[model samples]
Target: MSKDLRESEAASLDNEVLSLLGRHVSVRKFRPDPVSEEQLEAIIQAAQMASTSSNVQAYSVIAVTDPALKSELAALAGNQAYVAECPVFLVWCADLYRLREAAKPHLGGAATYEDSAENFIIATVDTALAAQNAAVAAESLGLGIVYIGGLRNKIAEVAERLGLPELVYPLFGMCLGYPDQSPALRPRLPLPAVLHRDRYDAGETVRQVKAYDATMSEYLRKRTGGAKDTPWSAIMADRLAEPIRLHMKDFLQGKGFLRR
Candidate 1:
């Protein structure tokens, strides 16, 4: 975190908010220091405090500390070395299996709600919200984290490895530890481009987007020494243009999450 980047926090809001928000940096490099048991407990306590739908708490987190398991998970998740190296790797799951079973007999020995996409969506949203809360808490405690969305690459294998029953799907993984190096803060879109008034507005979207691209390009140039460079739009376009296996539909289907 350089002086300019640190001060860029003011570009968003007041110094207090900037201090908190600016602490977020996706740490790929980590020191060998292990996160203490007490710190881990506090992080989880913060997660448990997050709001849940109907207070059903349809989510669970699995902390992976076994070296062999972490290595295997790293291989499954695009071979991201950080997964294997981190002291803690947490898998956040959209878990409805326990609740579904408990409600089965009460729902005339069948599912309380029809197995459908809507149910899956609810669980997914709940899990995501809870995981984000945990991530914020970890960062606030001086711990670094990187979300491993790539864990979806081999979703079924991961679920099986974790011994997850049907209706419990791995939503995402978070790698955690003491950061070895602090990466630069990535630029974000200007407020007007994303925030809208009463009705939706794209009037200034194009101009704001172009400006953001310029900001990102400049940031990357200074950070990467022009070795690898890309504008935000270009990166997004390339990713979306390709036939990426967002194989989430099939994964959910296999888990019997949205049978309808």
Candidate 2:
């Protein structure tokens, strides 16, 4: 293709991708309709295509459709009603169990690094990447999704409920179904705040964040009808001050991860 043609095609592709990504919003309220099996299959296929560390693909996804199981999982996720109401609750796991099994015969009882921090990071990153791809695919298919990090509130219970063996743990859950409510798109920090060039620029980042605080304050004011207008920085400060998910380290260790 000619240079101009190639640039035009690239821009066209960008627009298509950005159109879906830019309008992203978490859909908490879902309709009663169920997501079809075909759609679920396609979404998972897209998820599997995500990049993995050394092509190890150290991730597994569990689709919870049974009402009883979903109800129990919903309770485990801190009573997140959407977990039960949504047609499908997908539990994304950082799985080293499969890798361990596959390597066992080859290694002949050799010492393994699966319990090392590096492998843990790899598995977590791989799981996140795959889940994001699945999320985008579901959006494209007109299905709504909301990530349920609350699943970690009782992470051990969740793992036991899901029958996860050693070297595997539930990283997060996703609720998927048709939308019942259309929430406003939340604004994000300016690109300059996150995108650094060759080196980190702390001053530029601080400046951008201050500007974002004002933007978020206004957005919150409107969203809450003047009931609340807390600045983003203050909200984040409160978050940092709180002891959130303090058991994650212990839980991961118990699951035979991050030993080194």
Candidate 3:
């Protein structure tokens, strides 16, 4: 194991949180068990405790457990069967509607809640932070999770399905359940490539990326039992070559966000 893969450094730091975070992995396959309502509520409470911008708390979590809903959601999220198979699926939303309604009385028509880019960014940040907290809490309680960015692939249909109003956007979805498989841990880029003392360092990035690509290629081969090809650089290049949700910008515009 590389130094980054070892938990000994985390033990030296003497922080359970650090260790837990260090071992984080995206769990896909799950056991046939359900997470109880009580446990789900606890996870929501943990999510609510995450820091919000100016205490606005511009986020909402929609818990979907109905088999029918999960089935539709799974299909919508590119046929990821694990989504429907998981005990519960959560759609995290960036909710400016609550803030807009709340400001109606105070601003008295002065609040163009739909106009500012800052408010949009704030809601986005808040939703992501809250969802991450829920993920951490779920992991602590022995529940596995995988974030579904594919929710954005059909953003309009997703919003309509979830009954989201203007100023409320579905950011992403998460599937939670007990793990059924223990897959090899994916290696991350080296720390030096990310952390800098004072200013940004560009000189060492290319070398670091090359080395990390090689590491990831080996990890991929091992994890897939030689069934997968090892080409991190090509994978990334292919993904980046395609338009990531080509309609996202226009969709956000229709939702009245990112307007200066």
Number of the top-ranking candidate, with lDDT as the measure: 2
Q: Rank all candidate structures by their lDDT, best first, as comma-separated numbers.
A: 2, 3, 1
How well does each candidate superpose onto the true structure, as a TM-score? 0.89, 0.95, 0.92
CA shift of 118, model 1, Å: 1.9
Rank list by TM-score: 2, 3, 1
- Go through the candidates in order and give each one's C-alpha lDDT: 0.86, 0.94, 0.89
lDDT of 3 by residue, 82-186 (tens): 989998999999999988888888885673746588988999999999999999999988998999999998899999999999899999999999999776678
lDDT for predicted candidate 1 compared with the true structure = 0.86
- Candidate 2 per-residue lDDT, tens place, 1-27, comes to 354655676747565567889888999
Between candidates 1 and 3, the one scoring higher on TM-score is 3
The local lDDT score (0 to 100) that residue 76 gets in candidate 2 is 89
Give each model's clash number: 0, 0, 0
TM-score of 2: 0.95
Any runs in candidate 3 off by more than 4 Å, and if so which? 1-12, 111-113
Clashing pairs in 1: none
Q: Which ten residues in a row have the lowest lDDT in candidate 3?
A: 1-10
